[model samples]
Target: MLNASNPSADTGITPARRTTMLAVLMMIYTVNFVDRTILATLGQAIKLDLLITDAQLGLLQGLAFAAFYTTLGIPLARLSERVNRVSLIAICLAVWSGMTALCGAAQNFVQLFLCRIGVGIGEAGCSPPAHSLISDMYAPRKRATALAIYSFGIPLGTMVGAVSGGWLVEHFNWRVALVVVGLPGIALALVFRLLAREPVRGAMDAAATTVATEAPPSIRETIAHLFGNRAFLHITIGATLVGFVGYGTGTFAYAYFIRMFHMGYAELGLVYGLVGGLSAGLGTLLGGWMSDWAGKRRRSWYALLPAIGLLIAAPTYIVAFTRGEWITAMWWMLLPGLFHYAYIGPTLGVMHNLALPRMRATATALFFVVVNLVGLGIGPYATGALIDYAANRRFSASGLGDFATQCPGGVAAPGAADSLQSACTGAMAQGTQDGIVIMLLVFLWAALHYLIAARHMGWLKREAVASPAPARQPG
Candidate 1:
């Protein structure tokens, strides 16, 4: 549907304008993640205050938001290409920002869940357009670096979210914290609308010389084209697997610390927040830089970079799990966090390179669907369910079998083992620790996917030429 070779009507763009726009886009990205991460940081407090289960928390953090985010991203991205990207992004930001603040006002589980869904819907506009925009802003050679700078939002935003959410939640209630963290994005929405201009679409195409194509490929066609791409398929699957592990780790790490080592919110905010954030940020940037540098020689390194990083990361995370000392664990976790997130920027660049200009946003959205559905939607939920199962197992182990027994409706009906149930409940904290260990194994499994992808990287890149669209310039 999208002919990469097709050109739009713009002359070459100045580097200065590109740089300025990218900075603004990056700032907006930072806000996007900051708002998103804040909820994760305050998860425990929210759980306690709202009297919900970890499974429910997982739902809120994972599927409830990701469902809309992953689903709507593609259509919206398609819309961005057809309309003004800046306007689309601005409106989405405002909606999501308002939704974030609404989260603060939620008095019950249902309300909060609804608000999270709104947040997801709003955030759906982000990556597709941003990826598309960045592609317009930079040439392929420099795209990874620009993307890495944009991806820096993950770490920095995580840091800000963690520290800010932790501090606010620790001092006040989760609601107030939500209000404080969410409101800034609303202001950013206005700033973005006023200051940011959509760059000429497809302006950076290296080969095509035409003015423009009037319509984007149909959604079905975009999918068919992208899915037909072996590299896109492999990387999409690979990235999804990695996301499963990465997001799972992020969701549970703080809670695991609390259960195993008895760390509180403040400590988590301070130690994991600051340390993990810095490490992740550094990793994100480093990974991008390395991919761009290495990719120049071996185009396959775009995929290889993540493969190598994940391989190294798996063992370090294993060690991190066993560490009893908080300081020791924190130190070990820093680099691991950085390396774990390094896959983001390069992976995005790869997606941009592989897709035709018209479908860039839609391509990104499609990737988001896979990545978020598998990774964000299921990761935390699976881990939480595992934790819940572990809790049940712990209860049974303590001779609370009858008390923990499930009835016809999957409800836990009090049985003859109430005494044992009480005993196991007394040790619920330990059960949670064991569950976290089990969850860590998912990451190990995810790492293997990256290796598999690396082996096929050469074939993937070569396949991009199969449907090579004529290169185009910005309109």
Candidate 2:
């Protein structure tokens, strides 16, 4: 057994092994999201089948999953700080994958919601441990790029989920699609178990490579350390806000296209997979590369790049939503989809820099707590509630008879004087569109926070120059 006081550092991993490890991890992440996001494409069908409201759907997509996912992350991350991270990741993969398959058998809303919760429990185990391992494998200069490559799984998963799940749904049904996406991860878990070798904690940190792994930080110690860093706190907030709007709008985007443009599942999948996925994936990679490139000149550019990207994203998103035509809207949507993802690499890169080597996983968990609970937990649910509220208000003003009884989809706006079908259609389209539009503008708020973080980072860099720290990477 490895001694607690003299832990072994990972040594002699070949270039091939490093590349293989990264590839496998990325594949696992892709599978992770494939299960997580397939539900997004299935919304229109699920709504019709269950006769549920948007608010309830929002709960399924957001709070039900995010609550447990975020809440469980800290303890799991704390465990990872000591345990074999490879084994931990494998177990998590199986748990979430199995739960995702179980989602297919759900006959009702409650059953499906419970299954989603289970999947969340599994997914929470993924990124924190993986981030810690990757940081150990790569030096400071290359860490951001590596993490960004890992992040490609997100957009890649979105694309695959949208396409494959959508294709399955178009050909067969949503339930079948759910089972298909969920089962593969179980096998992939075994593959990762066989292949990945855990690295020494802090091996990639300058000069810290020689030190043995220290005792894991306590939760209080971890939190205190994180909160003490102003730049990390601000960047965390910016990431949270990004997730809020990003997840909120994403949860309902397919539904919007369905209601407004009458696009079918296959077409929606095509647009999201080909356009949104590729653009977002490329943008994530570009952000990491650019963060490293510009950050070489001035370290503060890490946060500065994200600020500029979010500002650009905010306006383009508004333009995308407000467009009347779907083709025109998709063209506009492409830009935001690409640029909006700029935060992932830098935000995470900064957090790793801020925390101690032993605290990387814990710090990652904390980041997720904010992003998942505050952002994912509330963003989609709040937006859904907004749609519900706006639609009801519109329906009430229209003086329509009970909307639930008359409308096919049973959504109505109070202010519209149209017939039942017209009322439902108009209300659904207008309410969802407006709710998303409002959420899109929140990017401006996130951008402001990133700017604040950049200022704090600048000051920190100056202090470090005055007295250098081992953790500080060379510019």
Candidate 3:
């Protein structure tokens, strides 16, 4: 059995042990995502059962979850620095797993909303500690690849959520699907608690002949340290912008595909959930590998490649959105899918490299907090709101408003057409087009942050006050 408490003082772990830890972390990550994403895939079922609106779905998916998830990450990350990380992660997994099951049982909007907040709070405890732990387990040279491998949870979870949740919903119901998916996380938590062990802080420091035995930085100090790193600031903001579009697209793409392409639930599961997700996973790994290879030659390659990738992705995504044919759209989707993921690994790598070992988790938590609040919290809502706004315009033009003067839902415009459905569809189509174009432009703005990060990469490396010194080999 593995030690669940502290690591050995000789933090120079064997290769096999390091590999085992990475595997455990990846598994934990997979469970983390599975719980998070199932809700997004089953949105229609949830909406139908609860009689909720799109705006409410946005809150469920974004703000409610993000509110606590973002705020709690810093405190949890700080705690990990001072305590046993593996134990912290195990405890969080249990809490979130229970909350996930609770979501399935919610009978009303408030209950479901509160459950989502609980899920977020639990998830907030996961990444920062895992990041800090992996930083010590692998040398700086290997950290990006390790982290990328761990990050595979995002796509893997998405695939499972899409495919499994879709099939379950078709056969049974959303409540049952949530229960099935949520229950597995509890077993995973026990497994982690039994098998995982905490690693020594700053264990990868190879250059320093003498170890620094000082305590970890306080919360304010950790934050101040991150704020001082210019490249991290630019890259974090850039990543947030990318997330705004990336996450926004993920939440709405199914609805859009169903509307635009008439894709069945199973079809949505196969194409976007399976094909699209697998591609993103591959892209994430490849991006990390490329960063490792290219970063060795020029550090700016960390941010440069992603900027270039996003620039290429922008035009292709526009084409993907404009297509009337579903097959044509999916094909175009493949190209941008490859380009879209090129940033995640490198961006995360840059973040870890810029922070002290003790502060890596805190830095990442802060990064996640801002990124999720601005990006995940707002992205879906922005799209839904835009669509709603466009709906108003469509109704106004069709004179439906006049027709339903006393109706709370309002009416279609006068010249819109004979049938309300056709008028609504036309308006929605136009609005959807405008909304997507606006979201795509967000990528262009995000790309600039990557470019700015590219220029400042060297400065970030120099700003590291307590980064692990290059590791030493045995004589």
For each candidate, what TM-score against the reference? 0.88, 0.92, 0.88
lDDT of 3 by residue, 93-212 (tens): 989988988888999889999999999999999999999988878667667788889998878888888888888887888888888888888888888878777766776754322324
What's the number of clashes in each of the models?
A: 13, 8, 11
Best by TM-score: 2
Worst window of 10 by summed lDDT in candidate 1: 403-412
Write one digit per residue (lDDT tens) for candidate 1, span 1-475.
2334333335345667667777878888888887776767887777666766667878888888899999889779888878888889988988888898889999988999999999999999988998988887776666778899988887788778888887787788789888888888878878877877777667777444332464677788778877665555666777887877677667767766765676777768877878987888889988888877777666667776777777778778878777878789888887677677788877887777767677888988888899999889998887777766777666566563532343111223357256543454444455555656666666556556655555555523543331222223357
List candidate 3 segments past 4 Å from native.
1-13, 207-212, 402-418, 458-475
- Model 3, clash count? 11
- Report the candidate with higher TM-score, 2 versus 3: 2
Worst 10 residues of 3 by lDDT: 1-10
Candidate 2 on 1-475: residue-level lDDT in tens?
A: 0012222334346668879999999999999878877778898788788778888888888888899999999999999998988999999999999998899898888999999999999999999999998877876666678899999899999889999977889999989999989999999999999988877677656446444546777889888777666666787788999999988888888888888898889888888677889889989999988886666667777888889999999899889888999999988878987789988887777667656778888889988998989788898888888887776666666677555555545444355445766877777788888889889889999989888877866733633111112222347
Q: What is the lDDT of residue 155 in candidate 3?
A: 80
TM-score of model 3 relative to the true fold? 0.88
CA lDDT of every candidate? 0.74, 0.81, 0.75
